[model samples]
Target chain A: MLDLFIDLSLFTMLVATGFAIVKMRRLFGVTMMTGVFSLLSAMLLVTLDAVDVAFTEAAVGAGISTVLMLSTLTLTSRIEKSPVHTPWIPLLVVAVTGAVIIYGTLDMPNFGDANAPAQVGVAAQYMERGPEDMDLPNTVTYILASYRGYDTMGETSVVFTAGVGVLMLISGLRRRRRRKPSRDEGEVS
Target chain B: MPEIEYILGHLNYWLFTVLMMTGLYIVVAKGNLIKKIVGLNLFQSAVFMFYISLGKITGGTAPIFPLDMRIDPATVYTNPLPHVLILTGIVVGIATTSLGLALIVRIREEYNTIEEDEILGIEKELVAQENRTLGDAMGGRA
Candidate 1:
């Protein structure tokens, strides 16, 4: 029953975001709504028993990504110039894809069913061995900080590189500032 | 009471979602930087809600020990995992916000306007002037 509610809420949030983006005039509002959609999706991930994924979704989706996108907005336009067009071809494709996904759901086990193939798979290994191998209490932490540490580390390095790039761009700006006073400062030497 | 528990359990999640989306919408669709930050906070707080919710158990007390007392084997224990996860997330969120604000301050200094359209227009004009100079320099090469 709770699963049903979670599914409904997720679908509603995502679909409403699509509609709101189409109807809204302000680009800022759309970005904010995208954050909302991401937050909702994170909640859905939690409900579906993917707590670690939920954490990443909540962090990357609503936190860092929103900030980065907003920063980009500072470099661009605020209001969308034109009303969104309803492109029939893309709409048709999305509709078909959505239909296929819904159809595929028919063959899947009931949400959280113990007998599901998904539950019977390598999940036990993740649960049982995760703590002993990684020396962490939480299986998700073991998975994130140890087993998938390389991937997360790569992502961290990407953020570090971006910070470096920003610093480089801004530092060159300081060089130009000092150069403007070169005639006065150079005379001192 | 069961129905009440059900309602309360999900109420936080519902409110979190609504507030988060409202903030995100403002950030994306609005012209103001401060408003965008406000939206960002909302989005982040919603995630915080998820973490808090995960730590809670029905009828369970806080995950604390009464060191002198004998432990009741039947007593339910609250989940501590989500709280720990959220603590790390909160630190990261604060860092991201500070970084974003710092970037905004720099942008304001350079562009003289926080409005997105105005900044873009100024940047485009600046680039266009440089392009014209380059075009003139290449005139001799052509």
Candidate 2:
């Protein structure tokens, strides 16, 4: 019962935050609300027994992303320009997509059903052999570092690529500006 | 009673749909690039929630085994595969967010604006000028 209540309340907060983010025109408020939204989802993850995910979400979603957004805001405009196009088309599109998803979910396994397909298959083997294979206290850590090491390596490379891409995107402009003493350079400096 | 049970049982999935759609709406409807990125993050997070919820087992505990290496045969661990997948996903999400913001910064530097419509207008004007110059050069045949 308590679990249900927590889940319901967190879901409520999440939806409210989403609405608030949509309604707010101020970029700063929206960014902060995004962090709040992440934190709320992290809490929900915790209730779903996803401690590792909750931890990562709290750190990345709520912490690093918020700081990055704030810095970006400092570099750009804090106020959003009102959209010139009518929102009706987007609204209609979203409603139809959402309805389809809800319809699809009708045949899905009930929440927390042990016999759900996701709970079986390879997952059972991991839970079964995790101790014998890795002997790690955290099954998530064991699987992430051992069974899925290659995937983790790829994810790390992706992070590295993103870092390099950001460096090139942001700093490459400065190198170009230095090459030409033009009006654009003057404005940038 | 069955109706209430059905609703209660499917509550999480229903809410996930709502949150996912809200994110999609923001991405589609918002004009600001930064707002769109935020919406994209929201959308990604909603998907993460859905996956994590799918891995939940009614009576399962967090997937951490005891440190003593003592195996409890009856222990039910929530599926850890999704957790592992989502960990990678969260890392990727932050990477995408940072890369997007970097691009936004560059766009602002070049165009002095990030409003999608204004950028489109600038591009349209540039294309028209290019076509006029090229069309006249080939004018008539070249």
Q: Please give, for every candidate in the order listed, the TM-score of chain B alone compared with the true chain B.
A: 0.84, 0.92
Candidate 2 stretches with Cα past 4 Å from truth are A172-181, A184-189, B139-142
For residues A1-189, write the lDDT of model 2, one tens digit per residue.
998889888999999999999999999999999999999999999999999999999999999999999999998899998778898999999999999999999988888889988888998998888888877899899899999999999999999999999998888676766765786567998
Give the alpha carbon lDDT tens digit for every residue of A8-122 in model 1. 6775675576457545657578668767866776776555444655677677768776776676566544655541333454445545644554454445443323454543455
TM-score of 2: 0.94
Each model's total of backbone clashes: 16, 0
The C-alpha local distance difference test score for the whole of candidate 1 amounts to 0.57
* DockQ, model 1, C-alpha based: 0.08
- Residue B137 lDDT in candidate 2: 91
- For model 2, how does the per-residue alpha-carbon lDDT over B37-112 read when each residue is reduced to its tens digit? 9999999999999999999998999988778989788988899999999999999999999999999999998788
Positional deviation of A123 in candidate 1, in angstroms?
Answer: 3.0
What stretches of model 1 exceed 4 Å from their correct place? A83-86, A100-106, A158-189, B1-142
